[model samples]
Target: MPARADFPYYDGRPVPITGRGWILLMLSVAGAFAALITIPAETFPATLVPASLFAGIPLLALAHLTKRHWTALFGPVGLKQVGQMFLFGILAIIASLAAGVTVYLLGSVAPNPAVAGMGAMSGTAFVLRLIPTIPQLLGEEILSILPFLAFLWLATTHLRLGRTTGIGVAIVSSSLLFAAAHLPTYDWHWVQSFGVIGTARVVLTLAYIWTRNLWVSTGAHVINDWSEFSFTFAASHVPIGTR
Candidate 1:
């Protein structure tokens, strides 16, 4: 087992990354695809699912490398911090809902303006789409966060950098990687997705700045994800042509 002493400790307590040092990374990502495969094979689009699957790999690698599966991915969080994170997440959701609603309303004025295109799908199909979204928020957050946190761990452990510097580097690196992961398909939707992701990254960074604990930041991330998922799901359900 790796020593907790060797792990980064922003609050003077070491973070652990043992059982999931490597394998958890693979499984979380694979689990995402496994969820995707649940969609009737033919119903799954080749374009989007592949990106989701690809996006999951980094988190998997982070989990495996750190040897801590969930914490590395989710940020070594605790219950109190979870509550705080939930609060921030609620704010994020409100912001996203406001933005989505604004977009919809703004579209009403333009000729053939765009919006989230869920109305095109049948009810059953829309429900099926929800399956991937659920796992995606949960799974991808795990994958997205772990490696960056792991990198923070490595910097603190090996480089003996200050907590702030270590965390700052981790946030920037993670966000950049998150953005880069979307490089292959730099379309409007992808840009929009990365923008949401980047904003979440900034929020997580704020949590780290305030608490200096991996747990708080991780919780913030999960909350952001939950917020995005809940809002996007609801937004998708709204009549596309209505707004």
Candidate 2:
């Protein structure tokens, strides 16, 4: 068996999920789902603050209960890692865009209306909106990464799956959940949610799996989201029909 150090993200050890822990994990997932479903679009930029807390607290507790180290999860990012993360983050964004374009060309999906609407916001409003995204993105990282580690632990320890098999399952399942969590934002569009967002999540998860550092993945996420927001903001300022 490989030493626990080989998988520091999973606490460098396999701790079986107790029945109570399972219950808590389920409750956390449910709470996050409920919070996402109820968040109103009209109050968005502001409501995101409370919604982040509502959705994040449970997953934060799960991380603690699972004995995940803070250092391993949110460790410092070196200068070199920052450059590497940006490169990976841009690649992830390109992959998502390519997927969306391919789907659109095939007439399998339409452009996401919510995304189109983002291009209508004034620059000031858009900048204000982007501010709160700092916490929101961090909260999202907790939502996705913690559950991913939990699922991985369960799959490898309880299900007797091989490490590679467990990782594959965990990545796909958690990425799906991450995509589903964006349903409210995407107005429940399956193509935008599962096709675009989910594909981006797979790339982000791969970053985490490779570095075993949440900060790396989170940095990549910030870059991806910020790039999108910037593009929309610029588009909003441009005169209509002026390419």
Candidate 3:
């Protein structure tokens, strides 16, 4: 195994978890997906249980692989990282808006039923769902970044791609997988899922690429979704004739 300068949490090695370690990592990822699909609960606090497992399983595997230094997955969340969050969050919002408009022009966009439910929730219930979303979103960041680095390693090492080309391959492959994961959520509408959600993932993944810190991307994801959630809630209450 060789060390590279791009991905973090690998102690500078691109493929830190080689041999048996990589297999364990894949198992954890599979286990996380299993928890997500098989868990019976669909609402609030109970939903948090599966979310925890989704993030915890791979993280614990990383912890063992990294010799208890898995905390490196998160760089310091100081003011700098907070600033990065807002910066990248805005970029992601812009990217999504552009992609959304394109998708809308090309074809109809399917609405997320979950967001539709947001308009009807009580204030407390809204906040309850919002609270769980933060951790769940962190799980999403994990789902994206870990595989990204894996693909990066594969491209560079096995495929012998130059670093730049390898990174491009990783980005496209990881974004495609992220988009595919949302197919069920978006009513199997490949156009909207790949157009909007996949486009946004590229911007969010840039946060990690720029800083090598998962927390920065997680914060950006929270800012992007939270702002959208808040706006949707507010807009839902607008008077019928106001538009």
Candidate 4:
């Protein structure tokens, strides 16, 4: 595995992003959340607008900061990478299952309102909602991977930590951030957020750490969530008390 902050845009760049750049990137993410609330998402299709901004703004800031090298962050998306996407996506789901079990044993697992909301949705409505997930999941992956890389840079460069140590710290820190982002989604359930969601993040992040490609990790994320959504939709249509 590449070490010493081999993250795209953070490495081999014309000008490396500085602390100020990190602040701007985070601010762009904050602005995205602002846009999400300011805009109406009552309709399923209307969600595309906010989801697009959520994915676009931080990505645009990253490209601008790195001299318009957006491709570097996306990396290659060939057959091999697609295979990795499915592979890591399965792994993430399994990890979340185990984490959910453990958390349930400890206390309770919070239900996801989004998945529950799909129970009433028609096939057409489900597809419409699925459309928004493309950008929404991309935005979710960007939010996680960017911070993972940033913390890796901080640990290796400033903290003078070893490569493995830096990666571990980065994964934990970024996972916490990912979990925190989902606080509202899980109805502010800290246990579920930090336990189940955070655990899934650890594996999804590894997809990126291994490939240095955001697309791979993002694809894995999409697979994981899409599978859940599909399951929810299918179950909703299944006749109750029937095999």
Candidate 3 lDDT, 59-129, residue by residue in tens: 98888887755766677889989999999999999999999999999988899887888898778888987
Q: What TM-score, to 2 decimals, does candidate 1 have?
A: 0.52
- Compare candidates 1 and 4 on TM-score and give the better one: 4
Model 4 misplacement above 4 A: 1-5, 11-14
Candidate 4 — which pairs collide?
A: none
Candidate 3's TM-score reads 0.91
- CA lDDT, every prediction? 0.52, 0.73, 0.83, 0.85
Candidate order by lDDT, highest to lowest? 4, 3, 2, 1
- Looking at model 4, residue 67 earns an lDDT score of 68
- Candidate 4 global lDDT: 0.85
Q: Which whole-number lDDT from 0 to 100 does residue 199 have in model 4?
A: 92
Report the lDDT tens digits of candidate 4 across residue range 76-187: 7899999999999999999998989988899866789889999889988889999998998889888888888788778877899987898899899999998998898888
| Model number with the top TM-score | 4
Error of 3 at 65 (Å): 1.8
* Angstrom error at residue 4, model 3: 12
Best by lDDT: 4
Q: What order do candidates take by TM-score, descending?
A: 4, 3, 2, 1
